[model samples]
Target: MLTPTDVLKDKVAVIYGGAGSLGAGVARAYTDAGARVFLAGRTEDTLRKASAEVGAEYDVVDALDEAAVEAHAGAVVERAGRIDISFNLVPRGDLQGIPLTEMSVDDYTRPVVQGLSCQFITARAAARRMVAQGGGVILSLDSGSRHGTPMLGGTGAADGAMDALIRQLAQELGPSGVRALGIWTAGVADTLTPEKLAGAGAPAMDEAALQGVLAHLDSLRMTKRSPRIADIAALATFLASDAASSITGTWINATAGMFPS
Candidate 1:
């Protein structure tokens, strides 16, 4: 009875980075789940194109600007009636696998500050709306940082801070009927690209190198294979639904076999 379609029927979902590959994948999945999705990003063209794929509305939003994010959230609320789901998929511009000594202070600090601030702004805005409207879900993706990665260049630190905030928000908002949760996904083949990594200060990560890294992670997985974006989307849909009503304040890894507990 609680299929993904049933889970999202008539709901309104907002994805902050909906134009990018990872965000697009989730947007498509959410649209397919019967929610009226809103896809937002910096580029209007990309947002429009990606929104077309999901039959969702497109908007230009700068998630980093709290005022801009608030305005966008208000518009989405006006259009959809209420915000059922809010997902922050903005790029963190994380520093590459540079050696700790080689990494610049700005390189390490920028992502942490950007990520935490963005999460704070977006989540707080959505939480306010959801609280006034009764109930909703907030979702985010991070590396989970369970196993302190030495060369991940402040990624773990940023994600760790996010994880902390989500748990606290879950506690504060659960009584008000808002669910706050996060996903940890490191390797998705379709999204791994040289340009993408370059934007995050990494040299270039080709499909081969990405797959190899994934394979190594798979070897560590309970399932022995890297999970796809679909896998992450599936769980996200569930978490955003009432099915995960009692699952607040937990960091669930959608990775197939990698980083198994």
Candidate 2:
């Protein structure tokens, strides 16, 4: 049985998009849980920073590029002897706040294509190595927006694709000793800044506006608070551990009860 300490001791974890805020948080949790984590992303500077903060190794690999992701998985296995945990936190270029009627076709399809492509590439690369090694965990994160979130262009389709992929992968890989699962979380309080919102094609909100939006989200949840980065990271660390060996083929809802299980 694994304890609170050393839950992931001597394990090798590869975190795609490890430079992002959520990625960094999960990387830190994995490191604290005693995994030798490798951070992979397209930006060297940010990856370096995140790796340094978490005492992890950094690799510049684009998750969307099949060749790069495959090579990275091979490199990690070459260096670590085995790949135990694979987590994909790569962002889909999703444009929100636009109704489907007014949204361009490109905007509607971008995330659906990019999200599924990257998830497939990274998950497959990790699964091959994991199957040969006996067993491992593949983790994915999605907004849980697929249930019917209006005004978020392509987000539902993209998230639904991811959910389906995780479920199907779990079924296919389970016999091979690979466990595929996902977490559904959204509106992380710390990740929602005006600049980031603007980048997602949402209107930049002022402080008051942001607070109001957050409050509305909180009110919608069973818990009257948003899930923090730390909350998601902690859940992710546990899910990656052997303690969660029997949990697969489904997404754990970390959406503060925004949706029923």
Candidate 3:
């Protein structure tokens, strides 16, 4: 069995949006797993802070900018010699809590566009290098809201688009010794701050109401508890490691059975 301490020994992992809550968690886990992690995001301050915590390197790059992403990938390979893993954890800029009937066309399509755009920009940049290097892993993440999560406005559409992209990318890249996959996770208690929820256009919730929401999510899961950031980080680390060499072209369920495969 591969232990967490060295599963990714000396591997080079580049994470886009590496300053966010989930990205930071995964960066820490990857560092602990002995990977040489390079954290990239638009915000230099937060990226520096996250890098400090994990002893990972930091870079400022916008994942949505194709030129910027391509340059950043080249820089990573220039420094690390090769890119073994690439993960995109960028925010999808989605607005929820409003019914589609009450939403504008742009509001309903923004996430879908942003999600596919960033995924393609970053994934293609990495895939090209991976093809040259002979093998690599590309990882993505989504809320798994595609299974009809009502009131989430554009989120479901975005997730569905991402699902299709990963599947297609895997098929096209697999022959080049590259693998593409994703994770479907939602309602991770640790990633959900009151401010984050509010920013997503959810109504402000008092402590009692917040607990009620959490309980509802728990009730929907077979485990009766939502997966946390640590759980997600561990799974991501495992998937990116050589231990999961056979896994590709699929989104692994990390939703605690909220949507069974």
Scored by lDDT, the top model is 3
Per-residue lDDT of candidate 1, residues 8-57 (tens digit): 88889999988988888888888888889998889999998998887888
The residue pairs that clash in candidate 3, if any, are none
- As for TM-score, the candidate ahead, 1 or 2, is 2
Query: How do all the candidates rank in terms of lDDT, highest first?
Result: 3, 2, 1
Task: Rate residue 203 of model 1 by lDDT.
Answer: 58
Q: What is each predicted model's overall lDDT from 0 to 1? A: 0.84, 0.91, 0.92
lDDT string, candidate 2, 1-261, tens digits = 766668999999999989989999999999999999999999999999999998899999989889888888998988999999999989899898888999999999999999999999999999999999889999999889887788989998999999999999999999998999999987688877778888888676899887887788899899888899899999998999888999999999998888767
- 80-141 in candidate 3: lDDT tens per residue? 99999999999888999999999999988999999899999999999999999999999999
> Which segments of model 3 are wrong by more than 4 Å?
206-208
Provide the global lDDT of candidate 3 against the true structure.
0.92
TM-score of each model, paired residue for residue: 0.93, 0.97, 0.97
Regions of candidate 1 where Cα sits further than 4 Å from its true position:
205-211
